[model samples]
Target chain A: MVSAGAGQAVDEGADSDPVIRVRGLENRFGSDIVHHRLDLDVRRGEILGVVGGSGTGKSVLMRSILGLLRPTGGRIEVFGQHLRDADDVREIMSHRAGVLFQDGALFSSLTVLENVELPLKTHRQDISTQLRRDLARSKIQLSGLPDSSSAKMPSDLSGGMRKRVALARALILEPELLFLDEPTAGLDPIGAAEFDGLLHALHRALGFTVFLITHDLDTLYAICDRVAVIAERKILAAATLRDIEDLDHEWIREYFHGPRARAVRDQTSPPG
Target chain B: MSDPAQMTEGRKDDNEADLVWERGTEGLLLATGDWVLDNVELLSDRVDALAGLASGLDASGISRLDASGALLLERLFHRTGQGPTAAGLRQQWRTLFEAVDFACDDTHEPAPASEAPWRQILERMGRSTVEVVHSTHELLGFLGITVHRLLRTVVQPRRLRLTSTVYHMERTGLDAVPLLILLSSLVGAVVAFLGATVLRNFGAELFVIDLVTFAFVREFGALLTAILLAGRTASAFCAQIGMMKLREEIDAIRTLGLDEIEVLVLPRLIALLITLPLLAFVATISGLFGGLIVSVVSLDINLVMFLDRVEQTVTLKHYLVGMIKAPMFAAVIALIGCLEGLRVSGTAQSLGEHTTLAVVRSLTMVIVLNALAAVYFMELGW
Candidate 1:
């Protein structure tokens, strides 16, 4: 199913509209500059993998696009609506977007089911309680979590399961745009692969545009439709993996042609 | 109205995409506009109402269709047991809808039934009782380890954390001096004024000096200072330790092969031991001074006469009794605070709960120990 959709998305790439348009993005912390004149476009229905070395501010860019941080200079347009100038656009974007933070960020006090139900309760206040529970339960199952995990605390779950619960919570709203920050960072090899597969399956099922920040080369190879590299205080390149790997830059050369990248490429089939 | 141009023209008036049902011979359901997550809620009720009636679903006019919208259509088709007819959904959207249909088939089982309220309460009570016993055991073990480490450090002075001890003494003791002095003075003056007013009725106004001296020196000074420190320093200790535990710094110390008791608990305990006695002495002096001032101002007794009366009526045993309880109170306060801190688990709520528990436990223990000491001293004819 994912292969079929991936082919279709690639075929339709030329005519697809840009869902997220970022231009002249700048982020600064006093004397420290994180991003400067960064520009990137996330097309509709594509998984855009964001990668950078440590301290390169990939997460900051995601935060700025998500409206969590006000960039020092940038104009961000999501779904053809400017984020900063319009309140209605922001509200619509929020309803349409979901973010899975690193560490799951699940409320330690609330059970998994309650965590998944929180967004529904906030956004759809008129839904009946039983209907809300049903929706939340479906989302949890959709994330491949067992029904038994619904009542358990976040602290009780393993790191992978916690990430699944966070995914369920993020998807509870049936969002059209999903932001994932290092979705498989701390998982073991098998768990990371399973998570990647789950993410691919969900994206195929949901058709949501994904903006994923990751350091894992395998994730970029296995799932991303296009990879964006950040370096030297700006987005160095944003292209298909084939194009990104062939880029002529010092850090890009070492990163994409490195032993780890070679291992990842050798392990996985070439991108479609 | 049947013309496709007219239908497209009508959609321009409504900015939001919607599912429109036609009950004519075609019996068609028309999906128009952007069918995305933002508008799925708007379409859900209408889709549910018309799903059973429509013979065919058409999406020829849809400008956009995302996973959420596709999922809704899949759910509608699943419920009505009808495949979409002439929908003309984009290839990507059709694949997504198919996936949703395949995935949503396995619904989750119902959650387990909750336990009865009375049973839950009883179970919680039993668990808490066990937890209390375990915590007490842990506290005693920690106290023993702390004492052992202190003894070892005393024998080998280089091993002692002298700098940390002095820093804590300045924080918990010296910083507390003004508040302690002020509180003891006010309480002493209040006691003396109250005693003199009552004793004047019996023409024994001069006896107020003896009353003030005895109570302040024997009970009020030590007890009040202990209670105040328990509320103030003990809660601070709990918060500091709880934060460290939450940050895993305590775990780091353990992994580094350093004794947590020696590093964390011993410095605090020793600082309290040194400070509490000194604070107690200061409390006794300030309290007596308060009493002397009250006697001089209110009773018109000269300073020398008030001192002479206190010397004649109150014995050195009273001062000794007050000072003797200081170290014990200090140990209890420090132990309870540090114990509660070590008990902290993950979460800010846990830190807050342990801090409150620290203050309450220390205050209660100090009062109970003071009463027990008073009884013992009384029996010993002190």
Candidate 2:
């Protein structure tokens, strides 16, 4: 896997063409500001990792980015297009920016192949049934599973395998931007690390932009080129992990300098 | 040490100051800068999001839970809290909370248990218990909102046109036939046998054909078939969709822009519609065949004589009325199953609860609809 910041490019166009720019974004469920005035810039082809404390609203920020949550008071510009209207959301989704939900969100009645085919067939109007099935077949293979998995329902797969299948579904339209929400939340450290490696491999291979909302520092350091911490209804820093370390907020520092952070630091740190 | 009027005046002044202070920052932000009211000032915004999610949502229309609180908290702490003064308390409290470190309402910091008064602790516990019940009732209100939404979807002038008769025929009609045939045949045989034993005393066993056909068409076949489908298929639909909803798969579909009822419920409704008429057909034939067997063995009436008597006694009209009642029974079953499935939320227990309710409601609706169809058809005459 590539080291953090190793994936940096000299391309200024992507930086200027920020795929999503959130300003003063806030979310609430009745009376709670889940995130308060969160501002962030997710550039095209940039793997921006969102990290935070348990209740800091990492997923909420992702929701706001997807226009799932109407940011209480702010702006979200997606692909230089503000997601202020229904049309913007439809436009962005049609561009094949996929979101892999934390629970895998595989429809139970549908077989694994059908789940992967769903997004493709549901969105497209002209693709024939045979073509859809063919695309679904390729997606099953792209997900790194045996052809036998095509007919099998999601209940038959293990958690880790289920995640890979979800990852495959996200890639079915060959998304330009992909959102992986807690891709490795409940996996064992080894499983998480393996998932981390798989994501890095895919990111490097495809060069597709990935916005990951996760708590795993190993994932943030091992794979993500930049980190965005969503808290206080704002993103603390939409910069590299090192830049976030320099941010020095209690929640951020306590996270990176905390026991979990220290462990990743020692492992990634150069020997004296 | 304080004058009472002076203390009261100071407190009122502080309340006004607090209100003023809040208005300057947090209150202003909360009032307008909030998510839904900001630039998204239209009711169409949520509908717009649902449209976005319609392409994204699974068949159940539930949305994914936002699961990133800790990361949000980390950012909150990092962005805004360092001063140590009366002025900083607001920022500190705001920063700590914006970080999601603690709930604004949770005042129970770990004061020593021995220092705490027992009466206060009991009173707090009692208050919390009441709050739990209050929330539970509010949860039902949320469910009512969901039900209202479902009714709105169903009551539209065009109604959705979800059920395809051909698709329904395959799933419901063919699969349900054998069981209905078996059940009706046994009931028919029992009725004929009971008739034969009594009719032997008078040597007038010819009326058994009339008894079996009339009873099967009027009462037994319609209700029995309804109960069977209600138990077997309707409950299964509720459980299946409910589980997908609980898994957030339905939300995933909605976010993806597919209509849930169109994808999940329509085909099943069609299947029931197709199946019910076919099942009624089988029930009538099997019941007649069973009575024919009883006639040959017990009443010394041959199959030919029994058929002739049935033709004379029970015409095409009775069977026609029975067959026509099928689609209404199917609609009632489908409506109940879909409604109960849509009611599902939260957990596995909720799925089980909805499934049981689907069965009960389907059975009730089936019986009521069958009775109504029978009455209306009879009112019109052959």
Tens digits of lDDT, candidate 2, B118-149: 88799899998996597446535644544454
Q: List the residue pairs that clash in candidate 1.
A: A206-B67
Q: Candidate 2's chain A scores what TM-score?
A: 0.88
Superposed on all Cα atoms, model 1 deviates from the true structure by an RMSD in Å of 6.4
> TM-score of every model?
0.81, 0.44
lDDT tens digits by residue: candidate 1, A173-223: 877789999999999989999999999998977778999999999899999
Q: In order, what DockQ does each candidate have?
A: 0.32, 0.03
Model 2 DockQ, alpha carbons vs. true complex: 0.03
RMSD to the true structure for each prediction, in A, is 6.4, 25.3
- Model 1 lDDT at residue A61: 94
- Window of ten residues with lowest summed lDDT in model 2 chain A: A1-10
For residues A137-207, write the lDDT of model 2, one tens digit per residue: 54555455665677778877888888988987887666778999999988999988888877775665455
In model 2, which regions exceed 4 Å deviation?
A1-14, A128-131, A270-272, B1-382
